[model samples]
Target chain A: DAGITQSPRHKVTETGTPVTLRCHQTENHRYMYWYRQDPGHGLRLIHYSYGVKDTDKGEVSDGYSVSRSKTEDFLLTLESATSSQTSVYFCATSTGITLQETQYFGPGTRLLVL
Target chain B: ELKVEQNPLFLSMQEGKNYTIYCNYSTTSDRLYWYRQDPGKSLESLFVLLSNGAVKQEGRLMASLDTKARLSTLHITAAVHDLSATYFCAVDSWETSGSRLTFGEGTQLTVNP
Candidate 1:
C-alpha cells in the first residue's frame, strides 16, 4: 500500500554465508528502516537511513549492516549468516516530514539460516 | 535506554466482548504508535498518538496516550473475528535522531465466536 517492495521475499542460507536483502520504495520517503521480528521480541530495529548515504545503528545491529545510496533504495546485509539471524526482516519508510507521521511497511522478507 | 512493555502477552476474547491492551514505557516520550499484524504478515499502522492525553479511534479500536504516566492503551469495543491479530505498541525515542521506535513484546489476540 505504501509502494514499498522487498526483494527475495524468502531466503534460506547456510551459516557463515553472506546474505543481503533489498528494500525499494517508490514514495521517495526520506527515512527508511530495517527491522527484524522474532518470537517474544516484537520488532527490533536493525538499522535505519535518514537520507542518501546517512545511516545509523539501531538496537540490534550486531550482525547486520545497511546502506542507502538513493532515496528509493535501502539495503540490509548480513556479513555472515548465523542461526540467530534467522527471522522475518521488514522494511519501512516514512516521509520524515514530521516525527508524528506513521511508517509504512513492506511485505517483509523471511530469512532462514541453516 | 528506553524500554516498552505490554501486558497480557496473549489474549483470547469472545466475539462481541470488550477488552483493553495496556502498554507501558520506561522513559518520557510524547509519541506513541499502535500497529496490527496478521500471522506471517507485515505490520499495519493503526494509530499514532502524538501528545499527552491524545485519543484516536477507528472502527472498533481506540487508542489513548498518557504522557504523564508513560502509558498507552488500545481498547476494543465489541470485538470481532477480523480483529484477531497481534498488536504492537511502539514508543518513539526522543533522544534519537531518526525517531527510532522501541517496541513492546506485542499482544496476540484471538477472537473466537
Candidate 2:
C-alpha cells in the first residue's frame, strides 16, 4: 500500500519487439528499483534509480534498460523481447536516508514473449 | 558475489502448526529484510533487521538476524490459512549503501484447514 502502480499489468509480445513497462509512485520516494521474478531464480534486480535521471545497472541488466525523468515515474524497456525475458517484473520504492530500509513493491507486470 | 539461500522451498502446514524458515547468505551484511508475496500479487514488507541479534515480531510472524552467522530466520506461530504465501529474504549488498538487494529463492508456504 505504498501508492505504487505499474502499467500494462499483463503483456504478450513477439520476439524482437520493443516493450516498455511503467512504474508510477505517489510517495515521491528517492529510490526506485526494477526487478524480475522467475522460478528457481527468485527475484533479480535489473536496474535502480537513486534519483531523477540517476540510474545504475544491477546484477541482471543485460536485456533491459531503465529511465527515470521524474521522482514519481520509472520506466523499464526491453529493446528486443526474447523468450528468456518472459517473467513477472516488479517495481519497488524505498524511503531511507542511508539505505537500511524495507522496500514497498507495486502490483507487478506479467510479460510473455513469444 | 553475494549469495542468499533459503531452505524448505515449499512448506505445507496445518492452521495451528508452528514452522520456521531459514535464510543463509554467503557474504557479510548488517541488514536483512523479509517480504511476503501472495499469488499474483506484489511483495509486502514484513520485517527489517538492521544488525546482529536484531529481532522483530508482528502478530504471528517473527524474524531474527545473526550477522556473525550470516543467517536469518523467519518463525511462524500458529499459522493460519491467510498466512499462506511465498516468503523471501533479502540482504543488503556490500558494494554500495543500499544499492542492491540480493534475494533468496523464496519459500512457498501453504496453510491448510
Candidate 3:
C-alpha cells in the first residue's frame, strides 16, 4: 500500500447522496492523485494535488471535486453521487522532486451507487 | 489528449510459455510506466521507462520502451502460474502541469498450469 490508506474501503450509497473519500499518506509525498477504475475504462484520473491547497483537474474531473488542506491528507468529494460514478477509487502518491518519479498506489475504495 | 492502447486485452497461457503485451500511445512522451494488479488488490508498480530506449527487468518480467514509435512492451519469460494478473501501461502527459498519467485498458492474463 506504500504507506497510503483510503478510508471506507467499501461503501454502499444511494443516488444523489453526497460522499467524500479520504486519502492519507505517511510518506509526506508532495504529489497526490485520485483515480477511478472501471471494467473497460481502466483507470482515469479525477484530480491531483501538488501541495497543500493546490489542486487541479484531470481528464475525468466532472462530477467530482478534491481538496488538500494538509500535506498528508487529500479528500475527494462527490456533490451528488450518480450510478455512473460507481467504481473502484484509488489514491496514489509520488515524490515531486523529479518529473519521472514513480507513483505508489494505495488500497482502493469500492463505491457502489444504488 | 493522449490516448494509450494495449493489445490482447485478454490472454490465457500455459506455465513455462513466453508472451508479450504491447502498448501503443497516440502522442509523444519519454516516460512510461507498467503496473500489475491482482484480483481484488491494489495496483503495484512494475517498471518505469524514462528514456527512449529504457528497458527494465524484474524476476521473469521485462519491459522496454521506444519513445519514437510511442510503443512499450512487457515480455514474460517462462511464465509461471503466479504471474497471472492484469497488466497496465501508463504514459506521462507532458501537456499537463501535474504529469498526469494516461493509462491504457489493462491486459488481463491468466496462466494455466
Candidate 4:
C-alpha cells in the first residue's frame, strides 16, 4: 500500500532451478533493501542498494544476489534454488540514511524450494 | 560487527499486565529502532530512538534508548490480547551504511484474555 510492490507473492520451484523476485517502488526512495524472514531466524538482511547500480552485501548475503539497475526496480536472483533458501522475502525503501526516517515495506513474497 | 540481543525470547501474559522487553547491542550506535511483526507478515515500524535517553510512545507501547549504555527497552502497559506479536530491535552502527541494520532475534509475546 505504500507504493512498494513485490511480485510473485508465492512461488514453488524445484531445487536447482533459477528464481528471480522483483521489487518495484514508486516513492523514488534512494535506499532499497531485501530481507528474508524465517521461522526461528527473524528477519535477516540479504542485500541493500544505496543508489542505482550501487549495492552491498548484508549479514546473510550468501547464495543471493541483488540488482538495482533503476531507481524504481530492484531484483533478487537465486542462481540455483536450494531448500535452505526457502523463506518469505520482503523489500523495503526509504529516503536516506537517517534511521528515524520511516521505511515502506512491501507485502512479502513466499518462496518454497523442494 | 554489532550484535543486538533481546531478552525473554518468548513471553506470555494475561490481559492488563505490565511488562518490558530489553534490547542490548554490542557496539555503540547513535540510532536504534523497534519493529513489530505478526506471524507470516512483514515488519511494522514501532519507534525510532536517535540518541541517549530518547523516549517515544504510541498507544499502549513505550520505547526508550540509552546510547551510552548501548541499550533500548520497550515497555507494555496494561497489555491487551491484540498486542500479541513478535518485537525486534535493530541497531545502526556509526561506520555502517545507513541502509544497513543489524537486527535482534526478536521477543515473541502472547497475550491471552
TM-score of each: 0.98, 0.96, 0.98, 0.95
Ranking by DockQ: 1, 3, 2, 4
Tens digit per residue, CA lDDT, model 2, B12-101: 999999999999999989989999999988999999899899999999999999999999999999999999999999998744534589
User: Model 2: which residue pairs collide?
Assistant: none
Off by over 4 Å in 4: A97-99, B94-97
Residue lDDT tens for model 4, A1-114:
458999999999999999999999998899899999886676788999988998999889999999999999999999999999999999998888454686667889999999
Please, what are the lDDT tens digits per residue for candidate 1 over residues B1-113? 99999988999999999999999999899999999999988899999999999999999999999999999999999999999999999999853457799999999999999
C-alpha DockQ for predicted model 2: 0.70
The alpha-carbon deviation from the true structure for residue B98 of candidate 3, after best TM-score superposition, in angstroms, is: 2.1
- Every prediction's TM-score for the first chain? 0.98, 0.96, 0.97, 0.95
Native interface contact recovery, all models: 0.77, 0.75, 0.68, 0.57
Q: Which one wins on DockQ?
A: 1
Which 10 successive residues of model 4 chain B have the least lDDT summed? B92-101
lDDT by residue (tens digit), candidate 2, A1-114: 789999999999999999999999999899999999999988999999988998999999998999999999999999999999999999999876654568889999999999
Ranking by TM-score: 1, 3, 2, 4
Count backbone clashes in candidate 3.
Answer: 0
Q: Is candidate 3 or candidate 4 better by lDDT?
A: 3
- For model 2 chain B, the run of ten residues with the poorest summed lDDT: B91-100
Q: Docking category for candidate 3?
A: medium
Model 2 segments more than 4 A misplaced: A98-100, B94-97
Q: What are the per-residue Cα lDDT tens digits for candidate 3 across A20-67?
A: 999999999988999999999899999999889999999999999999
| Global CA lDDT computed for model 4 | 0.89
In order, the TM-score of chain B in each prediction is: 0.97, 0.96, 0.97, 0.95
